[model samples]
Target: MTVWDRPEPPARPVPLDRERIVAAAVALADEGGLEAVSLRKVAARLEAGPMRLYGYIAVKEELLDLMVDEVYAEILPEERAGDWRAALGGLAHRTRRAALRHPWLADLLGGRPALGPNGLAVTEATLAALDGLADVDTVMRAVETVSAYFTGAIRREVAELRAERVSGLSKREWQRASGPHVTAMLATGRFPALARAVHDGADGDPEVSFTTGLDWVLDAVATRLTRASP
Candidate 1:
């Protein structure tokens, strides 16, 4: 066939779907943080128009919900731990891992209800772990309390990690840098506790710090659960 007469091959369909769109959005976020992700950028990455994404995701909020749930899928334990403490601990650690893997998740954690299937399943698994251990209210409180601890902890940890990276110094080193008001403030007798922590307290590894805090929270929850059970 002549060049103009040649049969035009059919146009390839842009395989637009929720999963693909979400994956693109996640990749964008992983590279440049959540604020970097947008329908236009995601669509561009997929070689489709922004409007095409709306069919799968009504708005950016829905996209964020999907992203958070996607991380929840990672947080779910492969097998339920034998006991409630183990189960909650496993879930909390897994969640921390997920947030570390996708720091953007820290921004969304607990910001909204997790109504997606995977997110709901995570809740179900968490509740199941505490089942029969306490009254419904106590069990609910235990879950919320532990969740609140980890979510806030992870956000703080990620913030510190970002700051450390930007400053090119570990947290302890940053605190130890002499002069510039911080040292002067520490020298003031009014802040004895703060000065002691900065000079004498060990700056533990982040993971160790996270696990220690988690264990403390779990211990508190255990007391409540035990009191309420049987």
Candidate 2:
């Protein structure tokens, strides 16, 4: 048969689409954390060639941006229900949990808040979450402060995880390893308060340590924001 006369094959559906490729990358991250989410690994998981993934994600950083935003989508915003304290506090907790659950997310928030759909959604949700909280400037400051604080806390926690990953140390073991530093600092009179804090804080519940500081910040901000509002 002539080439033109041969039966035309059905058009092949598009593969390696952005959404599917991004989704596969996200799944790889979720299953094995950020370290396991390389493009090659994701392609392997999707049964596609690594080059195919490049059609969707330009580079690993873009993939990370996509992943970061995807995880941000998981953070449900807190609503203003006549209790600003409850609202902001809940927002802080939710964002913190999202960062902890997907630890790489904490790293992303360190950079500027991107303007992608998921990133914009998070920014909008956060702003919307602060509805009627006084003037826009105050609201902006409050949101910025909360965002910075939560990101810092999550970063610290993730740093601990990364540090321990090398030695495979348990929480107690980490503290033990750092005990000499604490003792040395306490032995010096320069940081009495910090030494006391570390000594006292060690016995506290990990959740309490993570959640309370943000609550305190939000509490102060909410009160100040309410006072500043007309």
Candidate 3:
């Protein structure tokens, strides 16, 4: 056929890269949790052969790591004008908000080392906030301590959100009346303090609860830094 008569070469398929692959994987996970994401599925999403993804990611775990780092891009905060406490607290709040937006992230947070470029940037930001506050070892511990607190707190908050969704009950309502079992256990008086706290304590807003606890943790870190300083 003459060049003019030839069907325009079928449009070349869009090239697949790690970014597109990770994006497809993340969309799949967002729609259906981590279990929903597979290389084959990602490849299918991209309209490419499953093997096409292997060059970019050999296994699902690597894809998950990439997905986690992808979300970290959202978790990274804008510049702040306050001290280290404000910086770290801002980071923690951003992270919590990110996890809430992407609930699947709760499953992977702290499950493995975050060594990706974005992940390292997040770590660097956290450490940089406290860089001159104390010596290297103390600062490292402080970062770890704060990290551990928020990681566990975010996981629990996400868990509660899931549970609430399933039960169609707010956390306080769920605790007070999910079943007679909780009430019966508390009524037994074997856990008087627990019962009293449950009955007397106000179940305040979740964000407030999170912020208060984070402030407490930041305070502890501040104390450590002060003591460690010359």
Candidate 4:
């Protein structure tokens, strides 16, 4: 057959792997949130048939697990913090930063066990940081408490950030924009503490607030450890 007539070599299928699948899933999630992600959608983004992704990820849930683990890879610290307090604090901040970058993550963070290697590493680091600081049950509780705190906090932060984006108002501005309502409420005198807070401008910098609360929680964990010690 003439060169033109010869059947063209089949284009090699774009290499498919778990990493690429997860990356595509993350991109979709970043752009449209977790609910926007699906196996077919991710496959379309990767320019592959949905079936191709099945080889890499068994189901949509597995893809989500991979996406979360990928973020954990970013959250992992390069060097261990000097102490348990520092270690836990560093992880919390890193997690917050990650959630900010991928706000959709708040929906999945701590929603399910990671099971992936990177997720396992993050858990290991957290647990190891508290090793020898307390008994097994106490350490587990401390880890759970810290994780629960940060996950919930990050979700709130992201929600507020999105609200501000939609309303085009910062938190303080939103509160003040309701001045008429607030003023009327204050006149009622029933919400005295809240009225005083509004008048006093009780809201502090969000970052400062977050850090301060985190430190308090860490201190509580320390108290638990101290109580558990010999």
Kindly give the stretch of ten consecutive residues in candidate 3 with the minimal lDDT sum: 1-10
User: Per-residue CA lDDT of candidate 4, range 162-227, in tens?
Assistant: 899899998879978998887997898899888777778656777788898898899898888999
Structure candidate 2, residue pairs in collision: none
Count backbone clashes in candidate 1. Answer: 0
User: Which of the numbered candidates is closest to the native, going by highest TM-score?
Assistant: 4
Question: 1-230, model 3: which lDDT tens digit per residue?
Answer: 22112232222376877777888988998888888989999989999988767666766787888899899999776664267787788888888999888899999987666877778788887888787888999988987787788889999988888888888998678766755896888988899999888789887787899899999998888888999996
TM-score (C-alpha, index-matched) for candidate 4: 0.90
The CA root-mean-square deviation of candidate 2, after full C-alpha superposition on the true structure, stands at: 7.6
Ranking by TM-score: 4, 1, 3, 2
Number of clashing pairs, model 3?
Answer: 0
Which ranges of candidate 4 are over 4 A from the true structure?
1-12
Which candidate has the top score in lDDT?
1
lDDT of each: 0.83, 0.72, 0.81, 0.82
lDDT of 2 by residue, 78-195 (tens): 4443555655566667777887777767667768666567667666766776677688888888877887887788888877777788789977898899899878878988998887
Worst lDDT window (10 residues) for model 4? 1-10
- Kindly give the stretch of ten consecutive residues in candidate 1 with the minimal lDDT sum: 1-10
TM-score of each: 0.89, 0.78, 0.88, 0.90
lDDT of 1 by residue, 1-230 (tens): 21112333333487666777788888899888998999899999999987767656667887787788777899888988899999889988999999899988888887767877788888888899888887888898898899899999999999988888889998768766744687777777889988888679886888999999999999998888777888
Steric overlap count per candidate: 0, 0, 0, 0
lDDT of 3 at 121: 81
